[model samples]
Target chain A: MARSTLYQQVASELRRAIYSGDLGPGDQLPTEADLMTSYGVSRNTVRLALGELVNEGLISRTPRRGSIVRDRRPLLMYPQRELTPQPASVPREAFGFAVSQEGREPSQVIEVSIVEPPEDIAIRLELPDGGLAVVRRRLRFVDGQPYNTNDSFFPHALVRDSEIVRPGDILRGANRVLEELGHPQVRVVDDISARMPTPAESSRLELEPGTPVVEYVRVGYDSDDVPVRVAVSVLPADKHLIRYELERR
Target chain B: MARSTLYQQVASELRRAIYSGDLGPGDQLPTEADLMTSYGVSRNTVRLALGELVNEGLISRTPRRGSIVRDRRPLLMYPQRELTPQPASVPREAFGFAVSQEGREPSQVIEVSIVEPPEDIAIRLELPDGGLAVVRRRLRFVDGQPYNTNDSFFPHALVRDSEIVRPGDILRGANRVLEELGHPQVRVVDDISARMPTPAESSRLELEPGTPVVEYVRVGYDSDDVPVRVAVSVLPADKHLIRYELERR
Candidate 1:
């Protein structure tokens, strides 16, 4: 076999082990020297194989620790659930609800400010030229690990006196505040796309190389069909799965 | 300013031109010599700036045409439309309908076969351990350009005698054939994730380097809640956008 094929063979075996649960999350693989001795290949081949696994987001390599299998269990997000009426017992937002369902702690750091929104956000919100917006930016975490980011924008004129302009968590969620303002969202349109992370996103999310992110944008409209809010979520592809269940109506 | 900042400045200017429609699809960018002289930067810096645009899927580089802006307008996909009833004038599938709505030609090359599916697919289909499946694989195109790939799998026992087992296109779509077989899909669960494309997918889809793909899997169930079909679509992220509209019920 060609030398390239040899490295690929090693990678495939290790990938299989990870998928089969033989090598689990946080479980370290054999050291380079041990792998070389067992597979009868050079250290270069072992490194190449491990590199492949890292690029696939199946494993991570650190200077102190050898290659360790990563946690591949993704959080399932039900986008449709956002519009559903949540029980009063569940007071948190959709992200927190999903994480707590998985028995993980959820937290976030948020900053609220008013500024001229970006062109894309302006377009989605149907803002006129030079229209201002109040943006609530959040860096969310699950179990103390940064998971994703959500930045929601609302028309400044509409939410100037609302709780959304405050710099803190909305225990009842911003959607509820919108309802109290007499502009409850009756419908929403979600757009999903994916791409490689920008440098800023990579550092903020601590993503490994070759990791992509899903950019989900949802624009909520009130009863009068006026766009009220635009929420953009950047989810690490390896850590989240967006799901939608539809029934024929 | 640092050298890195200089290149980024150049990249930002070019990006603005593209987004602002000053540089359109198939429009050739300034040559390396011209860029170097205009920006008063080294040829190496010019290459780096152009490389960034290529990675962003905004431009393509070729030996003959140099660098040209790519067509970045994505096709809007409405997943909910599949479950909604279509008019008699629209005889094609959801994908074909969406493309034609944009005034673009839609076409596909299909291959049909029966085989043991991959483990993940089997689990989704709830197939017996040794059960077989009939797969209708399609390489779809828009305006004669390679766009995406969709592979729909049905339980072999259910579609063995159906048109899904034949080797040509289903003019009316495979979903209708399923309905005729007394297994109309009443509900569906869609799972959306993103990742770097495998070498095989890269070649088959003709994707650019640094481009990721949205892996969309939809499991359709009959009235009895038994999964009747599983469709997997590999969409190049730059070329497609999946949208969902939800109403509060």
Candidate 2:
């Protein structure tokens, strides 16, 4: 076995300190100079050690903030567990962008007011056929790059009549709008598949032939197990990483 | 709204059929001619629909065989509650690779050997300090591309001197070997994180600058939470998709 690097040893020591509660979350680790003096390592070595810690998601370092421990704390919930969507005291903003998306994007090219969801979505939402539902389709881009196209279905009775569902800002994030409407998502079930991108999908996503694109069908439900929205997103391969954090129950 | 192509409608219908169990897993779907006749669509349209099904992991098509239904079953067992490192009939071959990797074709590399685990892993494995463990590192490749890497740590004493421990053909995967050795996995806990890849990692994985990687730390254990192996996988953004089938409990 290769001898453990000096930086690795430093990283392990710091990690142990954090996990042992000697360094609490939000606490700052010693500065480079202090670490250098304490560990008799160079500035570069200290930086490398700190970098490893940050990469492990154990700490976050900023120019002004130095190196403070990160919360590495996310709520652990099962993917199969029912999550209730309720209003949040504070709205959370999560960014979605393709690597190649290079400018202002998430454009809304087409918008149509619909009275009902298609049979498939209606069945998933458990809504009656012809029931009022808003069907919105948007060709989303990030940084001027065409990335994904979203076709989102929401029950008209849920938000169709609200201003949040209107034309001008319908181009914004639908999830953000949904949160403001008192249906903060507590759970999201995403069913994903992949295949060669279609000509249209490929062109929109700027994918090459045979390049796989991941397709996700996301269902958002209320605490009552009532499906609120069914959304579809397609991402080009080489651009996105879908993540899910599972906690031991 | 523009009328969707007939092939899309057919594809969606077929998907719904499978999801609803109208077409059971491993059950062959109707032939393209039958589908064309049933939907009153062209052979091309039916072929397109079937192609989409294959991409979505819903069906498999082979020579002299029609599109056979796939086991679109959800392996959504909770990380907190699922049995692991145990004697079971579940074969590792059931899980197919999203991307093809074979031979020594420009893929990531992982070395297998025996070593001591970190304190946390040692404690979980019910071993004292300096306890022996089998360590395996795998470099992942996608279409001849270097993409990700994994390092798995197993109880060395438990697996040492075994064919599965010396980097040879693991007749069965790690757990299967453990079971044959009279230790079965009962549960597994996973820690997941996301961060920017390191310079070495970025270069080795052929990741573009500024690309982030997702890290997964999984510890498979026996019924008593005795950790058998702890695996750490670093997946690049460009080559992988992680999916979860959520069920409301």
Runs of candidate 2 exceeding 4 Å displacement? A1-153, A157-188, A191-217, A220-228, A231-249, B1-110, B118-130
User: What is every candidate's C-alpha DockQ against the true complex, given to 2 decimals?
Assistant: 0.30, 0.12
C-alpha TM-scores of all predictions: 0.75, 0.47
Task: Estimate the overall C-alpha local distance difference test score of candidate 2.
Answer: 0.60
The CA-based lDDT of model 1 is what?
0.85
Tens-digit lDDT track of model 1 for B1-249: 112367678987887787566898999999999999999998766766776676456788887999999977576788888998788777888888877765567899998889899766776786775789999999999878889999999999998888889899887788888999999999998989999999999998899999999999999999887789999999999898888988988
lDDT of 2 by residue, B190-237 (tens): 555445667889777777664556566676765554567777777664
Model 2 TM:
0.47
lDDT (10s digit) by residue, model 1, range A1-249: 112457678987887676566788999999999999988998767776776566455688887998898887576788887888779887877778777765567899999999999766775676766899999999999878899999999999999998999899998789888988999988998989999999999999999999999999898999987889999999999998888988987
Top-scoring candidate (lDDT): 1
Look at candidate 2 and tell me the lDDT of residue A54. 62
The candidates score, on chain A by TM-score, as follows 0.73, 0.57
Question: What lDDT does candidate 1 reach at residue A43?
Answer: 76
Most TM-score-accurate candidate: 1
